[model samples]
Target chain A: MICLSLFLSFLQIGLFSFGGGYAAMPLIQEQVVTLHGWLSMETFADLVTISEMTPGPIAVNAATFVGTQTAGFAGAVAATLGCVLPSCLFVTLLAFIYTRCRSLPILQQTLASLRPAVVSMIAKAGLTILISAFFLDGTASLIRENISVRMIVWFAAALFLLRKKKWNPILVMALCGICEAAFCAV
Target chain B: MEIFQKKQRLPVLLRLFTSTLYLSAFTFGGGYVIVTLLKNTFVDKYHWISEEEMLDLTAIAQSAPGAVAVNGAAAVGCRIAGIPGVLASVLGAVIPPMAILSLVSLCYTVFCSNPWISAALNGMKAGVGAVITSVVWDMSSRIVRSKDPANTLILILSFCLCWFGGVNVICIILAAAAFGVLRSLHAKKGGSAA
Candidate 1:
């Protein structure tokens, strides 16, 4: 039953995640954290961390990690399969039509419209996770005392490197970890 | 000719599988990264696909509802070897992440407990937030650049609905798509009348 739920939840995520991986983050958060209670907000943030560190789309990685966490290897397989099913099914059909007609204006318009919405979803997910990282508590409190200055500093540095220096995200992630570990050791 | 094509099919499928596997395994930061890798390998290296077709495939991949990386691969796969090709390519794309995440999940408890690891994750979590903010910034700016009032309106309204209003994202997306379709229809009618 757990495996079935994992599969179905991911199937919904896969079906609706139109923009790309990052755009799908909120939907994943909604399913795993809010709807299912499969993972807490903090663990969901950790899942994003691991997904970023790893070498795949966030949706697939999330499915595998959450599935494994909840129901072991079989669950991972089920969830991963669910996640990819939409891609396999729809892409093939679209590919066929695309090769025949060479254009899809309606599809194009829908995608154009979707771009802003996707950005909105991504922004919300980022803010939600950002709050969890900074506050370390639930989203209820908006107190200044809840903020973590170290995290804020690291976030600024990371954003600077990412935007100005064009540093690879994996490299930035690794640097963040090493620097944090070193700071803690001292 | 049919016999020759049949003989060539298995090797092409095998190559597709292995190439996508390597691409998916090595490309970090996902999405566009893997798509670029796919272009390099398929268009430039193997010469299995042409550049123009790849762009169209990318469009279809992007517009369709799924991970761009997987959709792109499946489109390329369909072009190359049809249904069997899709199967091979998707399996290739799926395996690396599944295997890697499964391994990481097994060690997650260990990851949580270790002080160094926990500290690292804390830092990485901040990094993750920064990265997401960057993505949001980049995408929003692109929409704003279009200067289309409707698109801009959609962007602002959707952001407000999702973030402040606590509306479900799925509804926002559907509404946006509907708005887009209606706007296009109106424009087309105006064009025809004019």
Candidate 2:
């Protein structure tokens, strides 16, 4: 039953997750944290964190992690298949039609409108995660109690290095990890 | 001749599978970044696809649902080898992430509660948040490039709807699609594609 539900839920996510992984974040969050109670909110945030640190698409990683937690390896397979099967089924057909009608005015305009809306969806999902990470604890209160000033400083520095300094992403994440470990040891 | 063609095709499929596996396993940040990596492998390295075809594939892949990286891989695979190509490509994409996440799920929860490990995880969480922030800004800036008042309005409206308005995203997107369909009378209207 658990596996079946996981598969169905992820299938829904895969189908509706337009605008790529980032756009899918909100829907994934709502389903995993709010609707199913499979993972706690903090745990869900942690899932997002680990998902980012690892490779593959966010949606796929999320499904696998949550599935593994809930029902084990078989659950993981079911959930992953759920996430992927929709894409495999649709893209082949959609791409063929889209390629055939590349210049259809309706497609172009729909895409144009979608582009901005996609941006907004990303912003909202990103902001939700950002706020939860930066400002929430077990219970999010506008400003999370556990968020230390040091953590904020480290976050900002890492962002600077990755963005303006153009440092390697792995190195930046490692630096944060090491700094956090060192401070915790004290 | 068909048998000979089958013999010729094996290596092509094998190469597509291995390269996608390598990228899926190694690349991080998000699927969008793989666009460049795919270019390097398929175009620069193997010469399987032309730069223009990659561009077209990427556009179509991006417009479709699912992860861009996965869609991009599937699209390229289809272009290069058809259905078998897609299977090879997608299987490559999922295997690495599945393996890694499974490991994390099995062991990390036990370690996560340790004070030091907890701290590192928290810091990592913060780092992830920062990366997401950068992505949002980057995407938003590009969208605003078209300078369409309607685009800006929709951008704000969608954000407000999703973030504060409590509107379901599917409805917001559908509404935008309908608006576009209705207002598409003037392609000359300056709404540049993001």
Candidate 3:
């Protein structure tokens, strides 16, 4: 039953998570924190950090982490499979059909119509992250108290540097972690 | 002898294994990051496809099922080396992460409750949030480049609906699709009548 639950939970995340892994964060948070009680808010936040630091998609990392926590190796396998199998199956089938349908007008039209919507989904995901970071869950108090000002500044600085220099994300994330630690200690 | 000869027809499985390893090992910053990396390798390095093809592949990968990074790799691989290439690249992308995460999960089970580790991760969360915000900003600018007032409106409305209204994303996607199709049909009719 636990394995089954792991599969279903990840399957839902994999199937519905449209924009990307970051976009899937709230959904995974809801599943692991609210519904399943598998992880605490702090731990979920940590998982997000660790996942980001690691090499794969956050969703895959979260699934693997939560699944292992809930059950074990078997649970990890179930969740990972649940997360990836849907895409694999879909792409494989699409590949088969694409060869035959590449020239079809309706398919082209449908895809063209979907483009803007996909862009919207991506943008909405960004807004969700912004809201969660700055405003959600009474973190407004921290911002009001001026404790979060440095953090915000760091964020903005990092954004500017990243855009201007095209620095490696891993390097940027590491530097942010170091700055965050320094701020907290001070 | 005949069976052995048939078995040697194509090294599909071998190619799949190689491609999967390559993607899984090299992909960083998750899927979006991988998309950029893929463009570098496939377009700039390999000349597997043109810039336009890369953009088109990204669109398809986003709309299709599974991880965008993997989907993009698989499609590109298929384009380059046929069905065998698809198998190779998808497998390459999936396996390493699975192995690494599996190991991390094991270690996490042991150290998840450690206070120092917890504190470090807490600090790291703030950083992760910042990183995600930066990525979103970059991607949003790219997506909203059309300068079309109507597209801008849809983009804003969609963001508001998803972020503030908490509507189901599938519904939002469907609404956008409906709007697009209807608008196109109206335009076509107007063009023909004119």
Candidate 4:
């Protein structure tokens, strides 16, 4: 029963999570945290953090994490499989259709339209995370007390290192963590 | 699409599995980061998929209903090797997250209670935000550089709606798709007249 529920919830997540991994955040929160009570909010936040620090897609990571926390190794396999089944099915079908229809100008144009919309979605997800990081409780307000100076500094440094210096992103992530830990120690 | 048919099926599938495994295991931020890496590995290094094909595949992957990383791997896999390719790539994409998180879950208490780790995570979050912002900057700049006024307009409008207006992403995607169909129909009508 536990594994079944885990599988079902992740299947819902995999089937309905459109756009990308970040866009699936709310749905995962709903199923795992609110609906099934598989994890508390704090643990969910930790999951997000770990997802960021670790490799692979956030949805897959979430499925595995939640499954393990709720059940065991078998649960992890079930949830992870459920999470990716829709991706394999949908993408394969889309790939088949796309290869068949790619020559059509209409199909080409439609795919073109998706580019801007998708980029905008990425921008929104970035801004949401930025706000969540720099501001308390993810409030968008820029009031004096709401901002974290340390985070802002780190954000600026990261942006410069990434865009200007063209530093390796993984290295940048490690530096950011080390610096933050040092700051907290100080 | 049949480019790999000349090659031995087993080796091709094995390479696909290992390549995606390496990419997924190392990429931390996920989504576009992994996509970018896949482009590097497949398009730039392997020369199996073309530049244009990668873009289209990415579009389909993003537009589909699932995690972009897995979808992308599956899409690329299908394109390269067929259904068997999809199995290999999807397995490669999923294995790392499951294994890593499973290990993390085994030490959940220590991980959660460590203030130092949380502090590091706090910093990493800011860095992640910046990484995402850079990706957005790179992508939108590419759109602008393409000099397509319609696409540029869509970029700005969608960003505003989702960020400020709090519009659901699904609605925006549907609206964009509808707009594309309309534009295509209009062009067809014009073509017929000419």
Q: Identify the leading candidate in terms of lDDT.
A: 4
Clashes of each: 0, 1, 5, 0
Worst 10 residues of 3 chain B by lDDT: B1-10
Q: TM-score per candidate, in order?
A: 0.63, 0.64, 0.64, 0.82
Per-residue CA lDDT of model 4 for A36-134, tens digit only, reads 899999989989877876778888999899888878888888899898999889889989998889889998888777778877876776777688789
Tens-place lDDT per residue, model 1, B93-168, is 9899888888888786565567886677667667767776776676678678888777788888988988889786
Q: A15-107 in candidate 3: lDDT tens per residue?
A: 877766667888898888999998999889878766754567777788878888889879887888788767766665665565567466555
- lDDT (Cα, tens digit) per residue for candidate 2, span B1-194: 01125666788889889988877765555565455457657876778776545655665566667887788888887777777878898888889999989887777656455677666656665665565566556656766776788888888988888888888666777788788887885554556642
User: Which stretches of model 2 miss by more than 4 angstroms?
Assistant: A1-79, A138-147, B1-85, B104-109, B186-194
Better of 1 and 3 by DockQ: 1
Compared with the true structure, all predictions reach lDDT values of 0.78, 0.74, 0.63, 0.83
Candidate rank order under lDDT? 4, 1, 2, 3
iRMSD, per candidate, in listed order: 5.6, 5.2, 5.4, 2.8
**Docking band of candidate 4:** medium
Docking tier of model 2: it is: acceptable
The better-scoring model by TM-score among 1 and 2 is 2
lDDT of 4 by residue, B16-74 (tens): 99988877876655576667667657876789997557767877787788898899899
Model 1 agreement with the true structure over A1-186: per-residue lDDT tens digits:
999999999999999998777789999999999999999999999899788766788999999988988998999988988888988899999888766654466666766776677666657667775786788574647687877788889989999998899776556766876888889999
Q: Which candidate would rank higher by lDDT, 3 or 4?
A: 4
User: For this target, which candidate reaches the highest TM-score against the unseen true structure?
Assistant: 4
In order, what DockQ does each candidate have? 0.42, 0.41, 0.30, 0.59
- Indicate the residue-level lDDT of A149 in model 4: 89
